[model samples]
Target: MCLAIPMRVIAVDASGLSATCEAKGQQRQVGLIMLDEVVRIGDYLMISLGQAMQKISVEDAKQTWAYYEEILNFSPSH
Candidate 1:
């Protein structure tokens, strides 16, 4: 299964074709071509394959991250 990461927009290019996003203290440039709305700084986006697929609310982003963290921190009983 493919996982889409939640990242916050840090910066956007002048043409608005791409943006710089950060998550877990890591930063990456992702294409914004999939979105039709304005992508402002601090906006949370669902990123996949080096592209921002959709804009998500802050609460949604936080909840997703919480789930991710839980999975990442999980320990098997084996």
Candidate 2:
């Protein structure tokens, strides 16, 4: 199964072709090539396999992330 995580857009590149997103306290690059809408900073996107697949509302992102957090709680950290 694929796991798509909701990540908050932290910084958009000057070209607006890519962005930096933060999720689970980690930051990574996300491509916006597949997206047609204007993706500004602070937007939330559903990311999977190193790509942002869809844009989601902040409220939805919060709820989804909450569930992920709960799931993470069940797994032990090294």
Candidate 3:
């Protein structure tokens, strides 16, 4: 099973095809191939398979973050 996780864009290259995204304070560089339009810094995106799958609204980002927090809080610790 796989999932496209939500992440926030932190930086975009001048070409507009690639960006740096942050999730849970971790950063990753991903390609914006599935984006419907050009992406910019501060945009929230859903990423999978090294590609950005979709752009997300601020409200959605907040909801997703809340879900993540809940999951993390309940996760078993080693």
Candidate 4:
């Protein structure tokens, strides 16, 4: 299964070709892929497979993080 995670963009290149994102205390490089026009530093993004899938509003990012926190707390039944 593929998992998409919400991350915050930390920096963007001058040409908007690439960006640096932070998630769970780790930073990664992501490609703009035509989204650089709308995205900017400090924006939240939904990322999958090392790519930014879409930009997410601050409120949505918070909600997604909360949901992931709950999932992390869950224990599988034996």
TM-score of each: 0.94, 0.83, 0.80, 0.85
Write one digit per residue (lDDT tens) for candidate 2, span 1-77. 99998999999999988999998799999988878888988999998888889999999999997888799789776
Q: Write the per-residue lDDT of candidate 4 for residues 1-78, one digit (tens) a residue.
A: 997889999998887878899988999998878464577889999889878888989899899999999999999999
The TM-score measured for candidate 4 stands at 0.85
Task: Put down candidate 3 lDDT per residue, 4-77, tens digits, no spaces.
Answer: 78899999998888999998889999998667798888999988888999999989978987887798789676
Residue 69 displacement (Å), model 4: 1.1
Candidate maximizing TM-score: 1
Give the per-residue Cα lDDT of candidate 3 at 15: 82
Query: What's the lDDT of the predicted structure labeled candidate 3?
Result: 0.88
The local lDDT score (0 to 100) that residue 29 gets in candidate 2 is 96
User: Backbone clashes in each candidate structure, one number apiece?
Assistant: 0, 0, 0, 0
- Candidate lDDT values, in order: 0.97, 0.91, 0.88, 0.87
Q: Which residue segments of model 4 deviate by more than 4 Å? A: 34-36, 76-78
The superposed Cα distance between candidate 1 and the true structure at residue 48, in angstroms, equals 0.4
* Tens-place lDDT digits, model 1, residues 1-78: 889999999999999999999999999999999999999999999999999999999999999999999999999998
Best by lDDT: 1
The positional error of residue 63 in candidate 2, measured at the CA in angstroms, is: 0.8
True lDDT of residue 37, candidate 1? 98
Ranking by TM-score: 1, 4, 2, 3
